[model samples]
Structures are given as C-alpha cells and as structure tokens.
Target: MSAGNIRLYSYWRSSAAYRVRIALNLKGLPFETMPVHLLQDGGQQHTPEFNDLNPQELVPVLMHGNRILRQSMSIIEYLDETWPTPPLMPATARERQRVRAIAQMIACDIHPLNNLRVLQFMDKTWNVPQAERDTWTRHWIKVGLDAVEDTLCDNPSTGDFCDGEQPTLADCCLVPQVFNAERFGVDMAPYRTIRRIVQNCLAMDEFKAARPENQPDAPAPGGN
Candidate 1:
C-alpha cells in the first residue's frame, strides 16, 4: 500500500529471500532490505522480535504497510495480486496451473529438503557427516531438476522461460534452485533444459540483480 516504507527481512544467500527480491524488482517496487544474519549467534530469525513477526524463524518476511507476509512463493503471489504489472502467471486457467506446477517443482519439491535449517539439524542433531550432507543436498536438487527437465521437455508451452518467452513465477523459483545446486557441487550437466533456462534468466537484469552475490549483505567471494 505505502510506497517507500516497505521492509524485507532477508539473508543474502537465502534462496527463499532471493525469490521475493526478484518479484519485487520485477514489479518495479522500492523496498528496503533488513539483513537478518541467519547464522549469527545461532540465527537472528530465532530472536524474540523476529519470532513475533514470523514464528517460523525464516528470512524473507516482507513488511508492506501493516501486513507481514511470510513464505517466499506466497509473498510473490501477493505481489502479483497487488501489483499485476507483467503478470507472473498466464491468463488462461490451464496455463496458470502449468506455471504454478513448474514453480512448485522447485520451491516445494526441491528447496525445503536442503534449506539451511534442515542441513543444520542433520549435522548437529543427527550427527550426519559433511560428505553425507552434501550427498543429501545433491540428491534432492538433482531429482527436482530432472523432473523440471522432463516437464519442460514435454510441455510445448515452455518457451525461453519456464512458461513462455517472458520470465514467469516458474523462472523466479528456478534460478534460485540452480544457484543452490551449484553451491552444493551438484553436477547440472544432466539437466540441459534447466541449465539453458537458468542461463537465459541470468542474462536478464531482473534476475541478475536478484542474485545472492549481488545483494548488499552478501558474504565476500569465498566467505560464508
């Protein structure tokens, strides 16, 4: 509602937070970012103030007017509903469903299993070794990307981007997942379609600006 006062609780490397950033930039909206260091002192998201804002203790809680939106995809949908310029979903019902399915193939099917908290739990609580953790991350990411490649290869609707020539919600979700995959040392040569799509999106200013390394709070080149 309000113009310049929008605030985003974010971590530079967070894939979920990265999705919301891309959506906001695509909508051409101005918002301030509040960096939440997810690893500092056991994660600032767990602090009382942030917990009150979002009990889930996640980065990327968007504050617009009095509304606090949680969950990356939900926030992106809300932005689409509120702003509606360069629509992220297709006009037809079937097309919209297809777009959402592609987006979920990454957001729902891939990201959650390898999120930071999940890995932390596996390492700390379960005592899983680092090699196994890398294996876990790579496994889920590859499975999701394989599904994406199959879906896009079959669906004629898929153009340069996930749904069409223009970047859609699916592209928003896909790019970040690709970034995560690279981070985990996953071999992406198997998913040729996904790799091509990610390359296309990377060339766009909107997606380029939303990259984790491009964020103001991003860690230095090799630093975590």
Candidate 2:
C-alpha cells in the first residue's frame, strides 16, 4: 500500500498502540492518525463502528488502503515486511527468535496484566481500590521486568538497543512497557539495563516523536 493511504486508529496512552507508533516512526512511514479516546464517551472503542473494525475493540488498528489490520504486534510485523528499510526483525533466525521472545515477554506477558480493560475489570467486578490496583500493577510489572532485566543483562547481543545497536521490534515493545511501568509507579532503580536501553531509545527522534505525550490525542500537561 502507498504511504498516503496508511491510517492508524490509536489511543494516546495505550502501550499497544504506542508500540505500533514507534515502529511506524522508526520505519519513516507517513501515516494518518485516527484518535480513539479510550476514556471518552465510555470508550470509543466500544462503539458499534469500532467493534465492526475490530471485534476485540482495541486501538492501533491500521488501515492500509482497504486492508484492515489489528493487534499491534501483527501490524508492526506487517509494516516491517511491507517496508523493509531499517528492518525491525533481525537477519538470522536465532536472532529473530531472541527479539520475538523479548517482545512477547512484554507484549503478551507483562502488558496484558496491566492493560486498561483488565484494570477496569478489577475495579468494577471486584471493586478493587485504586491504590490496591496500582499495587497489583506494580507487582506484575516488577515480576516481568525483573525477568526482562535478567535476559538483557550480561547478554552479548544486548547493545545500545535491546538486541542490537539498531532498534528492533523488541525495542518498540520495551519502550512502551517501560513508559507504562513508570506511569503505574513501578520502581526503575533495579532495572539498570532496561533504563539504559530505554534512555537510548527515547533519545532518538523517532522514539521521541512516537511517545504518548507527543500523540495528538494526549491530554495537555496541566489539563485532565
């Protein structure tokens, strides 16, 4: 599909959506943003219009020409395959597996536990308090990040980025998770490698542009 026809339906603070944004920016692809506010109007994602687009009702849906794509990881992989310059996946199979492992550890294991819906469910279904919910969020993030830190630390493949000097799919996943962890009050003092890599990633123009605060739908600094 042509660059002009690329459109992304994204939420400002959704880590999954953030992952796709990072990948698109890193690939230097120009895409239109269709903001879907997760908290407004009881979530625009729950509307019939959006439900038809994605039964899962998640953001970071990509419309490339007439094709519809959901799931941030899948969309990012599609972008990598469709636009190969500055490839996101590594060249070797083993290296690719390592990247995917790290990506999935965050995307599948860490992120899902603390996703908005899951947190909302905990609040509504179980009447979980905000402080308790935050504690819950922090616990899982620490658990997952602890494993990630172990994986990244002392690994030869770990460079300035997660797997190599150049940012890969793993970096796209890591940066957003770190953002969420920080937002939820997870302590970062223990994860030196993650902090180092995240600092390296955020210093880049692409990663900076894709940050949650930079998104059009993001709330103003002092505004709710």
Candidate 3:
C-alpha cells in the first residue's frame, strides 16, 4: 500500500493500539487516525460497524487500501516488511527471535490478562470489587514485568533499545506496557533497566508523538 492510504482504528488508552501508532511513526509513514472510543457508550468497538472490520472487536485495526488487518503484532510485522525503512528487527535470525520473544512476553503473556474485556469479565461474572480489581492488575503486571526485566537484564545484546541501539519490535512493545503499568499503579522503582530503556524511547520524537496523551481522541488531563 501507499503512504497516505493507511488508516488506523485506535483507542487513546489501548496499549495494543498504542503499539501500532509507535510503529507507524517510527517507520516515517503518515496515516490517518480513526479513533475507536473504548469507553464511550459501552464502547464504539462493540458496534456493528467496527465489528464488521474486526470480528474480534479490537482496536489497532489497519485499513491499507482494501486489505484489512487485525492484531497489533501482525500489523506491525506487516509494516516492517512492507516499509523496511528503519528496520524493527535485526538481520540475524537469533536477534529477531530474541526481540519477538520479549515482545510476546508482554503482548501474549502479560497484556492479555489485563485487557479491558478480561477485567470486565471478572467484574460482571465474578463480582470482583474495585480495590480487588486494582490488586488484580498490579499482580499480573508485576509478574509479567519481572519476567521482562529478567529477560532484558540477563541478555548481553540489550542497549539503549531492546536490541543493540536501534529501536526494535521489543521496544515498541515495552514503552506501551510500561505506560499501562504506570496507569495501574505499578511502580517503576523496581525495574531500573526498563525505566532507563523507556526514557530512551520517550526522548525520541517518534515514540513521544505516538503517546496516548497526544492522540486526537485522548481525554483532557485527568478526564478518564
């Protein structure tokens, strides 16, 4: 697909959607933003129009010409392969596997448990209280982060980014997960490497430009 033909369906606070935004910006690709309000009127994503685009009813859906794509990781891989400007993965298979491993540790293992739908299910089905819910979020996030921190720290390839110096797919996944963790009151003091890495990402204009607070659909400061 061409540059201007890209469109992203995103929610301001959705970390999965946020991941795609960062990837798009890093690739220097210009795209239109189609906001999918996740909290307004019981979520616009649940509507038939949005559901038609993605039967999964998820955000971060990409419309490239007539080809519709779902899933944040898959969409990002597509962008990297198609664009291939600032590469998101290394040339070597070993490094690519490592980057993907780190990304999946967050996307599959950690993030899925703390998604909005999962939290909603816990509340409506099990009647989980708010305080208990916060605890639930903290517990899972902390557990997953512990694994991520270990993965990054033990590896010799870790640098300013997740791999060497260039921002890879792993870094794209990390920054958003860190943001979501902070929102849910997961402290950063325990993970110095993660905090340092995220600081490096935030310093870059592309990552900063993709932040949730800067999104068009983002609420006013402190306004849900």
Task: List the global CA lDDT of all models.
Answer: 0.89, 0.93, 0.93
Candidate 1 lDDT score at position 200: 92
Best by lDDT, which number?
A: 2
Worst lDDT 10-window in candidate 2:
1-10
lDDT of 2 by residue, 113-157 (tens): 998899999999999999999999999999999999999999999
lDDT string, candidate 1, 148-177, tens digits: 999998578988888888888888899899
Reference-based TM-score, model 3: 0.98
Give the per-residue lDDT digits (tens) of candidate 3, residues 155-216: 79999888999999999999999999999989889898899999999999999999999999
lDDT of 1: 0.89
Q: Give the CA lDDT, 0 to 100, for residue 172 in model 1.
A: 88
TM-score, structure 1 vs. true: 0.97
When summed lDDT is taken over every stretch of 10 residues in candidate 3, the lowest stretch is 1-10
Candidate 3 stretches with Cα past 4 Å from truth are none
Q: Estimate each model's TM-score.
A: 0.97, 0.98, 0.98
